[model samples]
Target: MHIPARPRQAPIVAGGLPADELAERLRQRLDLPTWPLPLHLLPPGTALVGGAVRDGLLGRLALQPDLDLVVPTGAIHLCRRLATSLGGSCVVLDRTHDIARLVLRGWTIDLARQDGAGLEDDLRRRDYTANAIALPLGGPARLVDPTGGLDDLRTARLVAVSEANLQADPLRLLRGVRLSWELGLELEVTSGEWIRRHAASLVQVAGERVLTELEKLAAVPEGHGGLIWSLEQGLLSGWGADPSASGRLRSFTPEQATACGLAPLERAWALPLARLAALLPAEALARLHSSRQLQLRSDRLRRWWERLEGRPDLEHLPESRRLELQQELEADLPALLLPLLPAAARGYLTRWRRQDDPLFHPMPPLNGDQLQRELGLAPGRQLGDLLHHLTRERAFGRIPEADPAGRAVAIDTARAWLGRRRD
Candidate 1:
């Protein structure tokens, strides 16, 4: 764990601090690792580089557990060996690209051989000033910043590493916005112009990759504002339209959208069935990627909408009337509909509300079973017809007995009357 001395020069340009002065202050405050540089893996004349030192130079503690180290040679093998020594796993994510990830103690360390044959060349190829700086790993870890990342940090500006840097990966356009929003930093004018110019190119990237970035963006606290900006820049519309033409897709105001969007609304519903129905249209609902709970909610909403729409008489009704009709219809209409329902519907709902009726009231006193038992009628359309007649009669106070015998008598009398009709 022998540490190296801090470098004399800082890499950042902000805070009006000179390189050497910043370096000294960084060394005192940063919690840098004391691991020695593995110079044995370096090529001839290649000096060691540091990531911790750069973090320290920025006047912040290097609390990051894993280190990102760059060497002029043998990065692949070095990563493998480091993983083995540390009792972790080493993976060559892209051999052609010379990129590898080493996992040690639940931390992932990225190792890359300096491209362009040196550390400076490698730093020149990064995407941002903040990420372009490195630190030499030694007793105190020296900062090796080719880009003024610390200066950019202080100014709260996001600057590209170089003009040609973004061409390396078009996805960097999206990354720029995401990072800017996440860090609460304004994008440099040039970088923002480039992003706006190439906004449509985001479509060329894979869907999953694009979604991954979007998910991250959506999770940011001020993500809604950023997303709105992205939309204005045409980043989202280029992704393609939603599969269903439900027209649910629309721009979100900064205040309307937030990181809260990360939680699927269906998952948060206590009465998912009702909440889902209340929130989304049927076609839009079908297109949602949701759990079983949400699906049930969608179904319930659909049914409720159907019941409410079908019963025009219930509209503009009082709460009591709406509730009564809802009970009569055997449908679950939202309580909010009470005020919107018609006067008659409202009166019915009011009457029901005054009584101790359950949200889902029980069926009337008699059903088909009582008919079959008392009248010896077979199960057929007649039973249904008779029940309808009895229901109508009961609604008007024609039938008042709660006993099954009273209901049977009513059913027999209705059947006799209907039997007398020739038509």
Candidate 2:
């Protein structure tokens, strides 16, 4: 077993704070009761680095910040042990990179083996200086500023460790831009220049990665500004988006989200997807190399919003049609329908808001077996259609959820529906 080094002296606390004071400051910044995690039995050479360190140093940790640790080895076993000890779950995030993840409560801990013999080598390979800083787990809490990350963090500047560091992974290209917006930091002069120089290089990256970054950007309260910045900086263009629509998308300020009246979770998915739909051309979406599933969901969202924009009045439609549309629209993720939720759809929106209401709710006590047995309906396409129709009617309180007389009433309804079908 590797032994942790004894407590050692560190460089003069960058901000002139003494060791104990700095430790306390870092702890408070991260909302932690202690500087480093008090992992008494952990193997040596484990250090906390990346965004956890950055946020703590900047005094900007979220309500619960994730932990990022770099270790000499045993990344998998260590993460598993951590998960077991903490009553969390462990998964290998990337086998090739020897990266494992341990999820505990609301916090995630990512552990990766050191890329080289020393922590400095790992820091040098990191994307930004703000993320390269480290705090050893073994010794007295001493800030590790291998790439001058401490200085950059204090200055609120985003400085890339090196061009090759970013060039090696084009995802870092968008990551740089995303980070600037997330942290409210101004990019360092040269770093900003490098981002622009390599914006188009992102096409070489995968669409899922690009979309993931966009999703993250959209989740932020300032994400609208971030999205505008991404477009203005040619990052979206690199991903084959139509940059001119940034102005159109930028118009969707946080105020408009408030107007949409979607809960926060709903807003996160809908607003971003809506902006992307508005900005990217029909063909542009296909060009991003997104997975088919993502494309399908996106297209469905676009269709719903388009329909809402063209005709939002669902009250006039037949009850069956309205319920059909409701099921199509709500689908558990009402946030995806935010763009389509024009004021005209307020009636349906009001109904949805009353989640406890059995009528017009997404989940209701309606199923196929009851109709088949009660109505003596055979299993076939006709029975299936009847059940779907009855489900909607039942969901809307137009029909009883359960039939006492062996579904005699449902039998009449099915006969009437079939008669209408024939007519």
Candidate 3:
């Protein structure tokens, strides 16, 4: 296992921008592994464009530094070199058009060549004027704002380059609102009008892509505001969400989000699914058919829907039945349902309101082996059935918590059920 000695390279130092404070600050903001002069990093004639430039101008702090660069030619291989130079990874996102990405130190540099003849022509085909921005490199680099993106950036307004251009991708209508939410920009009157006009075209786009974009807007608590706007403007109607779902989500303001529940939603793994289930009514949510994308099982959703039915007066239910709901909250509570948890169904919501660590519910103290050991059984379907029965009984509060001795009651109940099964 002889390995070749590694070579050490020079420290990365980025080239200077015009002696402007803002420009230098943006250069430093680049998520580069090291600040080596980028003059010799990529091939000649590469330029920075799109969100990295837009966000830099707006002085927004980038959590995950991403820079979109367009080259004159041979971008895929060039990006591979750039990725290696930074001791990172590269992936060819699109082979036909030669789009590639270099991922380094939480920074993603997407490299592609100018799609059309020149950069200005390329900028013309972009969706929004605020995103149709560029900054040329390796020369007298200056801000190129052909679509008046600099002006839009200055005023904190979003403007589509053209109606036809925006219509090319109806997703842009939603993305406009996302950028608005992201950078705190207001969608321009004309751009908002254009979204309302062509929002229906989103149906023609791919569902998976729509889901992808929705995930971006749902990744953070602030994203709820964008989702609400999209639903209000009919931007999400094309994706099969009920337009009325907007009003429901609009009520989930920062205050309500904090009050009702937040830890589960804010740090959700399937954020889009959490957002959808939190915003939509029980019946409206069933229509999404999103289990595959959300990685949620169909039967679990059915059980959730069933619970909403007979949304009875929990205050008036029999003592045992009220306790059943409380224990049910401890068994497999999905994060999405946290916001809609009524004040009465279970005290689990109360725990969340008080900022508890286990926001949804707590795990049981036992496992299959423990149950089997307690009942004097080996591995088999009958043992599993008994274990599941005991677990369900525990969920219903037939077995008291706060006492390991109480588990024997559940074990006895399971053995009696097995005796009946034998008969």
Candidate 4:
């Protein structure tokens, strides 16, 4: 049996505001007056719950906030009705649990039947105190705080609703770590302990579910720190996170990528790829059932990073080696540059951004068929080798464009090379 910690002092009033004031703030932040889903259309017992209320209270609500509603019953049916009435689509999330989602005009509204006996029971069964709060969406939005979720929010702490609740879904164990870093909150001592205790159980979760959480964590600004903490607590050990890799992940930060001259859109994906590559190898991602493209990206980044580790100066590498690196990582060069010195990384990025840069986007000066017709070369290993040689020369600016004069230059170069091989 697990027992919650008693407050050191008398219980503080929830949210430091009266119910009406809190309700007003939530209503204003969530833009309730302009809601696409008319409140009157909802069931009488429906109450807004989960992240919508949480982010609204924090004043971090997005322009198009996702709404999570708890209903007394018939949530799926209500979702179908909403989809039909609003000219939208309905996706059944869980048929057995009576959970469904309605997507209308860029808004996602999830409706779920209240678990246990009532709304309060459903809130209490949630994983974290900060997420367990609710607000009745019917007449006069009264704040509901059955688990001191507001108080936890006030203190900027993440506390589990209960050990049993976390055990009910072991993914919550990892979710605690992600939420702590993503929301800039500290983990309460007891909740931290509970998460650490059940760290190993996270592997029991579905691979896709685990990958989703990891991707979310990796996308945040403080994701590297969160990953390190997860590693220290042994939460990621089962999924192929090595303690030795922590040093690499620690330096994978948005500021670092920015210093390397990665633009906002580039950093959005590059930083996450760098962080994931730092922490997990390609095989680990494969085990997580990640996409083949993602696995290839990670593998290329990791292999190149390792290759560069032995040769600190990129310019010092042989021309062919440097060309090979550029050829393999043309699209993802920014991700590979995360760990390099800022000056060097900036130089590389400037060239990489130029789509027509021959070295960055390497292409052979002449196709194999063209080479065969021009040089009377048969289709064999020698032909392939000659084509590779031409691409290298083109990438290095030694070969001209494939025009009549340039073809004459290429044929001359090819004949000279063939004569040398014969010698």
Which predicted model would earn the best lDDT?
A: 4
Compared with the true structure, what per-residue lDDT tens digits does model 1 show for residues 336-388?
Answer: 23213344434444444434343334334467887788668789887776766
lDDT of 4 at 14: 43
Candidate 3 C-alpha RMSD relative to the actual structure: 8.1
What is the C-alpha lDDT profile of model 2 across 1-423, one tens digit per residue? 011111122223347676567765665465444423446646788888887767665555655567888899889988888777778899898998899988877667788999987988888899999888888776676777778877776677889999988899988978887788777678899988888888778888877677777767665556668777778878777556666666556645556666656666555565666666655655666776655655665666556545555443555567665665666655433544344345643444566778655555644343567666665767899877876776665666666655464255556676688789879
| Quality of model 3 by C-alpha lDDT | 0.62
Span of 10 residues, lowest total lDDT, candidate 1: 245-254
Worst 10 residues of 4 by lDDT: 1-10
Instruction: Say which prediction, candidate 1 or candidate 4, comes out ahead on lDDT.
Output: 4
Local accuracy of candidate 3 as per-residue lDDT tens digits, 151-240: 666676888999998888877877787777766678889888998888778777666566566656765446778888778777766455
How does candidate 2 score on lDDT? Answer: 0.68
How high is the CA lDDT of each candidate model?
0.55, 0.68, 0.62, 0.83
Candidate 4 C-alpha lDDT tens digits along 1-423: 011111222222344787788777777667787878999998888888887787777655667778899999999999999999999999999999999999999889999999989889999999998899888888876888899988788888999999999999999998889888877779999999999999999989888888888888888877889888988899988888756878888778888888889998898888888888777887888888998888888889888888888443478779899888888888889888888888888998888888878898898777888888877889999988887787888888888875877777777777777778779
Q: Rank the candidates by TM-score, best first.
A: 4, 3, 2, 1
Error of 2 at 164 (Å): 2.7
- Would you estimate the TM-scores of all the predictions? 0.53, 0.73, 0.75, 0.91
